[model samples]
Target: MSPAQAMERSYATLKQMLREGAFAPGTRLEAIRLADELGVSMTPVRDVLHRLAGERLVEANSREGFHVPRFTEAMLRDLYEWNSALLIMAARTKRPGEEEKPIAPLWEVPAGADRIAALFARIAAAAPNHEIGDAIAAANDRLHPFRIVEQRILERVEGELEQLITRGSDQPHAIRRYHLRRMRAVPDLLRERGEA
Candidate 1:
């Protein structure tokens, strides 16, 4: 593979592992070990680490190497609030060029985290601002692991989403409830993973 390809592969693998809670917070992510684990060169590992560091997914110290952030319950609530606001913003903002589709009846599909994500993505994409969508996506990257880790939360909120789509009630209220499900679910999940 080319150097860029190697970097991309390593970056994606590391990101997946992080989301899955494969590494605990404060665990040292060494370049050589990770390169070997991902079947890539140390160069790609370093490059990916730099990118993750930029995203605040990992912290780099000159002496201590990269560390995962200790994501606390309060921080999780803050993210939930930020995410809820984003959904509200998206629901409120009118997309300039795109004609708004009536909200999809998402309940027809089998419910899961991915399905919930697609639902939220539809809400987010309606926003006229590309920057808002991008911010939502960036937050999603940090938040995806929680979705995977606790699929039940998404499953639990399926009815709220259906109501949002079917009744066409206020969009932000339903979206806030959806975000709150994760906010409520994270504490137990973090404790289960011993990351709390």
Candidate 2:
């Protein structure tokens, strides 16, 4: 593979691993070790880390290298609220001559975090503003880890996601309630992850 391909491979791998919680929050990511594990050179690994850091999926410190960000309760709450705001804005903002699209049936979507993420993405895509979609996508990446924790700790996660998918992008109230449930579950999610 070419150098660019190698770097893209490293970036995609690291991004997927981070979303899947392969590295715990606050764990330092060593480029040398990751390069060895990824079967790529350290240069690509370093570049990938910097790119992820720019997206806020990885935290970087010049002295300490890169680490997965450890979320405080307040930080998580704010992120959830911010995501909620983005989704609500998307729901309310429709482009001229844009028609509403029907979401896939709940059964078609995988349960848990996947369902939640997919629904949110569709809602973001429905918005007229591409920036809102991009923001929601970033928020999805940031919240992916916590969403996995919520699957283990929070009750009715699947049902809640089903409601959001069913409600579609027209109801800002439903979007607010969906995120509010997640915000309320922050404590449980933290406790389950032993982060509290």
Q: Name the lDDT value of residue 5 in candidate 1.
A: 92
lDDT per model vs. reference: 0.74, 0.84
Q: List the residue pairs that clash in candidate 1.
A: none
Which number leads on lDDT?
2
lDDT for 152 in candidate 1 is 45
lDDT of 2 by residue, 1-196 (tens): 8899999999999999999888877899999999999998999999999999999999999899999998888999999999999988887885544344555563587777777888888778878899999999999999998888887777787777656655435478777887888788888877776577
Clash statistics: count for each candidate: 0, 0
lDDT of residue 51 for candidate 2: 99
Q: Considering every candidate listed, which one attains the maximal TM-score?
A: 2
Q: Candidate 1 regions off by >4 Å?
A: 96-111, 152-155, 164-169
Q: Candidate 1's C-alpha lDDT?
A: 0.74
TM-score of each: 0.82, 0.92
